[model samples]
Target: MCRGQTAQKSKRAKPYLDAENAEKMGEHLRSDYRDAVDFGGETGLRPGELCGLHANYVDRERGWMWVREVLVARRRVIRSFPKDEDVRAVPLTPKAIEILDRQLKGRNLTHGCGLEHTDGTECASALVFLSKRGRPMRPDGVGACVRLASKKAEVPAVSLYATRRGFATRAAEGGLDVFALADVMGHGDIRQSREYVQQTPTVRARVIAALGQAPPLTVIHGAAGASLGADRDQQPPSETGIEANENAC
Candidate 1:
């Protein structure tokens, strides 16, 4: 077991669930926070950003969600800045949009969490995920719920941060480059975003397969192949059924 200084010097812990396992974990969670779990798995938003999500920032028609602010759990405050202090837009999959749609129908936008915009207009947009008392959710509460659900689902135990890692992994699998993944993750440094992506066996296999030394047999018998080699090289155009066009430039 790594302890003390050794633990500190070891690779930073990065836990994540693949897409399928993440869905299974969501299945075991109670209805109260189930959507939150699903959303996290899909969007890869930070816990504070998830808790701070507002209806106004969601553009269902465009299929995008803007990360404008975060719920500062420790301070018990709503701040108009993400962890990197940079606002970013994250694309939504159809499944993610579905989760948001359901939450939109059930939430009372006139009340609940509120945020003060920078333009001197104090908007009282309701948070997407809220507590029983209609306040912003804390990270501790969210993490506890994730652990309970993971145990029930019989999947690997993963923290809420794992959802972010999962999203990064899924994105990488879908062919997103490191720089683009960094932007979507709201990461200030590309290196931090690179840490989120995990290489899977399937990806490794593909890389190896691309190095094959020979082409498929079908290619050798095809038009291009038939035109190549011995007799064909000495054959006249007429014998090969190849004709020259008089109109050619």
Candidate 2:
């Protein structure tokens, strides 16, 4: 008897919150960080990039923000560039603009670090998102808030990275190509951006519908043992003709 073959289980991608769930999560998030979480969903920015955003980099007139730096959460230090040195510009949505305007209102261009450093000295920087104490927001701290909010919202617990992935998934569903997605996400490789796009039922339906709309293919056969060829312009043969041709082959 032949041995039975086992099918391998496919690994599931990380969970991501859509716009509706994001709003639900926001309702449960601390007011102080609600805008930060919302902005993350809008821009698809990594938590570090979001934390290191500066007033100088925001081009409000053009509706774009440059990802020039990242705050290292563990060391509480600011790096000049983001991961993979993938500095890129993210276009601001109307919602993102509103969030920025609110955060920047009456805020100084620069300030001392809100959190105490290892040396017991404050790091001076101009960061966009800050804690209630006016300190730089850490990725882990934002993640903690997201987890708590997810629980309260009765959604799957997600990290800050989920916000970024959610952004990518939304963009993909909106017909944005992987190349553009990669650029906006500050991904050095297109494959990294591709991974963020989930193949949801809607996307799969779109693909199937698109393929279904294509013109029907016509098969042409030549001499004996000839390979089959498609001629889209050629009309299909009648059933009787098709049977006759098969018998001839």
Who wins the TM-score comparison?
A: 2
Off by over 4 Å in 2: 1-12, 82-85, 110-125, 196-198, 207-249
Top of the candidates by lDDT: 2
TM-scores of the candidates are 0.71, 0.72
Candidate 1 regions with alpha-carbon error over 4 angstroms: 1-13, 82-85, 112-121, 196-198, 206-249
Model 2 per-residue lDDT tens digits across residues 95-146 = 9999999888997766653433344445564677866656666566667667
Cα lDDT tens digits for candidate 1, 131-204:
54454555556666676677777776777777777788778877788899988998888878765454533454
RMSD values, in order shown: 25.0, 22.1
For model 1, what is the alpha-carbon lDDT of residue 193? 71
* lDDT (0 to 1) per candidate: 0.65, 0.67
